[model samples]
Target: EKTETNILKGIERMRRFAERFALAAAYPIAMEIIEALQRAAPVDKIEPAGSLRRMRDTIGDLDILVTSKKAE
Candidate 1:
C-alpha cells in the first residue's frame, strides 16, 4: 500500500511539473512533426505511438515509428 501511494504521489508530482512548465505539445503539433519526418525521409510507414497514439491531452514527447528503404 505504501509503495502504491508513493507511486501515485510521484505521478502527481510529474503531472504538476508538466503543467507548470507547459512541457507538452498539442496533438496537432505532434502530427505536424510526424508529417515533416515522413516528408523528409523515404518513409514506407510512419506513425505516432506512445502517448500520442493513445490520444493523450498533452504529449510530453513524440515517439515515431518509420520504415524506409533507404539505409542510414
Candidate 2:
C-alpha cells in the first residue's frame, strides 16, 4: 500500500512540474515575434490571436504565420 502511494505521489509531482514548465514557455515566444516586427517596421502592427496562447513542451524556435494585404 505504501509503495503504491509513493508511486502515485511521484507521478503527481511529475505532472505538476510539466505543467509549470509549460506555462513558462509562452511569453518569450510572444516577445521575440513582437520585437522582430518592431525592428522591421511593418506597415501597421503585428497581433496575436486571442485564442492562440502559449503551451507546454519544448519550443525549438518562434513560429510566425503572416498574412499580407495590398495597400489601398
Candidate 3:
C-alpha cells in the first residue's frame, strides 16, 4: 500500500509538470522539423508519427519515425 501510494504521488507530480510546461507545437512547426530531419539524415523512410501524423492541430511532442539503409 505504501509503494502504491508513492507511485500515485509520483504520477500526479509528473502530470502537473506536463500540464505546466508541455505546450503543444503547431502542425506547421512539426512538419518543418520532419523536413529538416529528411535533409539531415540518409533516411529510407522518414515521417511524423503520433498526433502529428493524425493531422492534429497541435502536438505535445514531435514523434518521428526514421529508417536508414546504412547504419552509421
lDDT per residue (tens digit) for residues 1-72 in model 3: 999999999999777556332225456676688788889988898877886777664456677888999899
Give lDDT per model, in order. Answer: 0.75, 0.58, 0.73
Which of 1 and 3 is ahead in lDDT? Answer: 1
- Tell me the lDDT of model 2 at 55: 44
TM-score of each: 0.61, 0.36, 0.57
Q: lDDT rank, highest first?
A: 1, 3, 2
lDDT of 1 by residue, 1-72 (tens): 999999999999887666432325466676788889877878889888877787766566777888888889
What TM-score does structure 1 among the candidates reach?
0.61
TM-score leader: 1
lDDT of 2 by residue, 5-38 (tens): 9999999988766634343466566778777866
**What shift in Å separates residue 57 of candidate 3 from its native position after superposition?**
4.1
After superposition, the stretches of candidate 2 with alpha carbons farther than 4 Å from their true spots are 1-21, 50-72
Model 2, CA-based lDDT: 0.58
Error of 3 at 26 (Å): 2.0
Model 1 clash count equals 0
